[model samples]
Target chain A: MRLTSWGNLSLDDYQTFFYDFNPNLLAKIPKPVIAVGASRSYGDVGLNHLGSNLLTTNLNRFINLDGNLVTAQAGINFAELEKVLNLHKLSLPVRPGTSYLTLGGAVANDIHGKNHHLQGSFGCHIKSMRIWRSDSGVIEISTQREPDLFFATIGGIGLTGLIIDVTFEATEFLGNQIKVENLVFSNLSEFNQINQSSQNYETSVSWVNISGKKNGNGIYSRGNTVPEFAKKITKAPISYPKNLKLNFINSTSIKIFNNLYQNLQKSIKISLVPAGKYYFPLDGVNNWNQVYGAKGFYQYQSVVPEKNAYEVTEEMLNLMKEEKTYSFLTVLKSFGDKSSGGLLSFPMAGLTFAIDLQNQGEATLKLMNQFDQIIQRAGGRVYLAKDARMSREFFESSYPNYEKFNSLRDPYFSSDLSRRLLGF
Target chain B: MSKILVIGSTSGIANEAIKIWLEQGNHIHLYARNHDKLKMQVADLEIRFPGHKIDAFTFEANNLSKTLDQISLDNFDIALITVGELKYSDELVGQIQVSEKLINSNIQIPLAFAQTILEKYKTQGYGKLGIIGSVAGDRGRGKNYLYGASKAFWETYLEGARQEIWKNKNISLSLIKPGPTNTAMVQGRELGNLRLAKPEAVAKVIVNGMERGKSVIYAPKIFQLIMFIFKIMPIKIFNRLSF
Candidate 1:
């Protein structure tokens, strides 16, 4: 069977297996497998190109929920978890840009969102997890118990083992309402300053325009949860029309969209919005990625240190302008000093930016390679979860601890990313 | 808050009705043949609606009499019967054993369970009973005569029961005849020409009919007109028709 992740950049044939509710049925699948959860990763991180992918989407179930903790099967995604948690006035501490990612996928990717400046990545909030190892039997690991395996598995990209269930701590919220403030920014420096001044808010992000006309103009937004007593408690159905898929995101269309988006947000000051609208705006239109035409698109995300943040981002934006490249969405977020225990966790005390560009064959690949060089010069690293093509040497140089992680990886478990980087 | 019992709870129709009742802060007991799926579904329901009480049991609906005896029902206010089986293969038309099993699953089992529940509710003098019937039962078609025959039997049975039970103002029985609905039972069948009703929409009709003390309901509303036309059609014309 052929499968493509969220990026839709590449589709490769894979051997997929489903493990139902029966526990004994899991042991029947062949070894050398990569456990896939929702297959939300942009690249081949969730796909085992050489072997089979043991799909865990069907194993979704709520195990338990205590005072401030939630235990759910790994197959459960944030979309399902958020619905259940909202009923109890609780919310996830660190949610990614998209809520469709599975719990296991979040752990494997160690995803971070606009709130990363405070709560760190998703792995930082996990209390404990259970995994079915190929070398060993079923095992429960945590930061205190099996620290080595736990840390390795936390952004291990499913190379460690098959994660069965996860127990994580969640935050109690007033309601699903959020007070948002959007401010127009002039350049990269202004965006950084705005992000720094908005430390009091729960979430902060910047939307940039990278086309030729208004290249550096953007809007910086900050949001905080509405107070319990003041919240309106408006519940709207999260339905996306199936007919909204439009393959109109070519060079011409994106340029028009970029201008319109910048103009729309240039005047907005403050408003109250739903948590879903504030956190996952792309979710408003289902399969929003299909707008990038039949060939799909690629996301290039890189994080540079505080000192090189302004210069590195400016250079990359200038390069895109010089190349006459077009990207529909260019998002920027700042990371906090609080690091995750995951051995290969992506976030650091730096500035991260993600740009979505349509895949135009060799031209797209060449442009990405150039961006990689610029990022490497600024001592920045690419996020593996969002990467479709990054050199193996660059990956090794960026993550110096890869050797230790490789040694702990399950002998029978492998993925396309691991095969590309570690020559497995 | 009413306590409800849902039979064949794993079916799409039963699940949608369960969600509506749970959202209203009602307690529900789910019964299905697959224990593992039932447990997972029950846990999911509990998580989705924390304040409501939810429980699950594993037993075949074909033997509902033996199954119901094992479950407790002290203060149950409503019962929903959504158990059914569909056989569409042309190969099974002349097979006597297969047809008999289909009759048992679609007619005998549900009828027996409905009769037992109606008797118990008749004594209680204040309860709601909901049974699912298909619009295909309106007129026998050559394509799916076995399924049509079973549901046609249920319509007659329900009509007679409604006459006997409707004298009591407190007791209500709903006969829901849903049109072509999107479900696993009709997976491979073409539905381009027929208006496909969502299971959620059909489930709502069933629940609403029971709430309004309605004895008969044709889901999607248009099915009522379609069925009326079928009922009035001449025997000569109906016999010659394929559908």
Candidate 2:
């Protein structure tokens, strides 16, 4: 089967095995395999190009739900989990931009969301997990038991083992509606000020215009779950036609789209939106990446410490301007001080910027390398989940705990990312 | 709320169908071959649909008679039989054990279970029954004719049973003929360009058709026409074509 990350980059053929509800099946699958859930990661972190890719989507099933705590199989995506939680008037403490991400993916990536400032990354809420390792066999781990392995596995990028199931705490929510407020920031400085002011809000993020025409100018939005109950609405996603061969997204179109989006949001100060629409707007347009063309796109997400955040971001924007590169979607947000237990966790107390650059092939790669240099100098690390291209030296430097995580990795399990960065 | 009995409840299609029925406020009774798997499935269903009644029983084919005898079927308003096995082999004569297992799983066991359910439904005076057959049953193909032949037996058996219950307005039976569905049964098969229907979608159609009292249903609805075309094709042309 041909597999690619959510970025649609690094497409390659792989021998795939579906994870049926049996641990013994793991032993049968030829190793150096990686377990993939939804393959929502933007890079090759979920891709096992050299070996088998264990598709865990079929492993989806709820194990138990007691009050606010929920235990479920690794393959159960947040979209399904949210629906079940909504039934009990509960909401996930932390959720990524897209609900299509499976629990295993979330834990592996240690994903952060709009509520990161208050709730921290997804791994923070995880109570325990059952993982199947080729070297160690099936074992259960948590903070109280095998703490080192437990922490390493949290953001271990599926190299630690294949997560079987996870138990997590879900917080209570009043309703399915979010009262959202959009505010505009003229620059990175202004955006930081506004972000600080909106810290009380449960969710906060900004869509920056990285075309360099406006530098750091963007729309900053903050939202919180409204107290009043609203009926859950489900609209069938519109899928992009597979046969369409043309790329509709370009620098010209991206600029036009960004300007139009900003202008449209200028008038909308506050409104009530469904949680799904607020959290996963892109999900409403299935295969939205197809618009980027067959060449696909690269999502570069990096987090820098708070002190260097402004300077590093300004340098990145200037670099993009110098290179004449345009990003279709540029998201900027802040991470809270609450650190995750995952040794290789991406989120830290810093400001993070994620931009989707159209694959201009060599030009894009060169530009990304420049951004990587700026980030590395500022003591920042590119998110492995969204990185398709990053040097091994930079990876080791960025994640000081990399050696420890490497020591704990399941020898029989490997991924394109691990092979590229760790040389396994 | 109605009581629903689902045999082979752990199968992908049956599990999905049971979820739909449960969501519609139906209490479910599950029966599967694996005790541990059945327990896990029951726990999963219980967690997903809290406050709903869910009971499960595990039984092997040989002890199926004793298992059926132990559980009362009078309360179940609907019964869905989704048990079957699919084995592909070109060397039929040499693989006696494989052939026997396929026959026992796909034909004998399901037929016996269906007979027991039909008899109970007749005695209960009012009940709905759905048995999952396959599109392959319309005409045996070279790839999996043994499995196809077993389904053909179901087509004939259901046809006769439909006739028996035609006069009884309270009793109904539906033979669900699903095309290639993306389930564990067809997971590893080389489906070529054939698009497998989602088990959830197939289950929805099956449950809906059974509720509406349809005698026969081809899930995805496209299979009915495809099967008709195949059924009318000349033997020479059919022989030349390979799946």
Candidate 3:
């Protein structure tokens, strides 16, 4: 079983409907809500909201592919999109964790990627899109057609409207290779400085010791698209094993692995790898989530404005350290855009870090809440797509344009997301 | 705007009751544990019945103290209670500690709201207290005696409360005795000669009894006759036969 909560009523009903019209589907037979997303999200934002959910998987059809101009459905997964574009030597400027989300979902999240400084979010790459307005009918929107819906859809959390299909801008890549570099930062201050200085520089990311709130800053990875000459496929980095949860691998083993990981990251110069390999390391194992075990893991991703980046980073680390809650991957990156179509997004021209940890009870919730408060005050926010838990008040406060987003959403449709998020 | 409150509104029975209220163009206030579950339901229900006014409030029917503190007794015109404990763990039964947990979650806790709500209804001069009880409360049997006993107490309580207020308060209390209808509680066993009633069906009877001002009703009607025949049988013979 994929245990994939697609936020749909029946895997069977969803499977059959290629399409079905419920006279009052949203208002009537709402199923248990579990949000469904690209699974790239850290939390239940995309997990099913209830018994029945709207499936975006099929929204991936390529409606029009004219030369470099391609219009595709929002439900199309990125992986398949990449395969098609790869055949034609084309690339989307906005690429997130993995190619497993609908184009609509991408825009709904207003996803930011490695080259956000240069290109901005996935929304910026979107030239135009067609939305199924709840109040209105289907309308084409862009900077021109229907600006409100267009902007709202860019980061609107699917609340604004249904992203049927979007026209995305593309860039060309020579070979499918991951160009990378590595650097090590000493502490929290150094990491913050590195992130700010690197803006408009490279698609750089860093890993830190989130376990130690006291001295939380640890490792950094500065990377960029290697020049065609430097793009060489060598060997894949030793991928982590599947079906293994190192969440609590004896303190001794954790200490040992931590030491090795820190050391390995510390002594790094520059290396060339496969493009797909660098973009998606975990894509190798089909059911890699199983590594977190049956209980699953919570991915805590938040964005802090440029000014409060350091404090946010410091506080997050200190809380995790104090709680002694360990994480497998604590990654730090930068986001450029201010908003997306979804009512709530995690970007605001700041440093965004995603901490992946095995769900370990109150410790995680407390730490995440502590971090949430900090980010909220700093005028930062969490990505709804990657969120499983958040207060309605907090969510409303986080997104400045929440009211606008709500107006766009079809009040009649009952998505599990709408159910859970709305406190139904 | 008939403000209706449906307690225990997150389950299947609650959903059906909510739908009926919506279909009838009445105002509704849903109550549930997890707010998210109720959120979507309200939205969907609103869609189902476009003009119905609806809202949701949270309450744990078993926690009388909290329910009293949180729930506004006058916020609704009608109070519907589906608050009852139907399940008992073998371990708890064996340990004999279930008496408190089950009773609190089911009996005394819900009964606590009677005076609170009835007082409000009496003051207002007109209101209905529709409760979903069970025929199992008619008499205690061997298998689920604890559950049956709790309902029996509730049934008897309603019967007494009905007389105490009788002529003065347009406040009506209808006891809905829904006899064995196949539900998640009764998973597989077929009730031969006794058609298993659907929750929708049970909910309808409860609604009918409340609307018709009938003090008590056995859902499916046949169950009442069967129970009457059983009730009139000699004690020795009744004890000798299997249910």
Number of backbone-clashing residue pairs for each candidate, in the order shown = 0, 0, 63
Model 2's CAPRI class? Answer: acceptable
What's the i-RMS for candidate 3 in angstroms? Answer: 17.0
Winner on TM-score (1 vs 2): 2
In terms of lDDT, model 2 sits at 0.86
Q: Ten-residue segment with the worst summed lDDT in candidate 1 chain A?
A: A228-237
Write candidate 3's Cα lDDT for B1-243 as tens digits: 578877767554556666677777787777666576566566445433545578787765545576675554455677787766565433356656666777775676567666677777767778888776777777666656787777777677888888888886567897777886534344222222444566677777777777777778788777889778867778888677665
> Who wins the lDDT comparison?
2
Model 3 error, position A93 (Å): 0.6
Model with the higher lDDT, candidate 1 or 2: 2
- Where is model 2 more than 4 Å wrong at Cα? A211-213, B70-75, B90-95, B186-195, B236-242
Worst 10 residues of 1 chain B by lDDT: B186-195
TM per candidate comes to 0.77, 0.95, 0.56
lDDT of 2 by residue, A95-154 (tens): 888889899999999998988989999999999899988777789999998899999998
* lDDT tens digits by residue: candidate 3, A1-424: 1224322111222211111112233333343322234545554445443343454453334666666777776666777677667656677776776666667677777877777766777777778987665467677888888777677667666655556678887777556654566666778777767766777554666777544333765776656665463444444345545557444433455556676787776676667766666676556655555555545666777887888687777777776766776665778887765444434555778788787766656766777788788888887777776676666777777776767666655554434345556643
Task: Give model 1's DockQ, 2 decimals.
Answer: 0.17
Local accuracy of candidate 1 as per-residue lDDT tens digits, A266-363: 76789887787788776666677766655778888899888878888888898888888888789888888888778888888899989988888899
In model 1, state the lDDT of residue A270: 90
For the record, the alpha-carbon RMSD of candidate 3 to the native fold, in angstroms, is 21.5
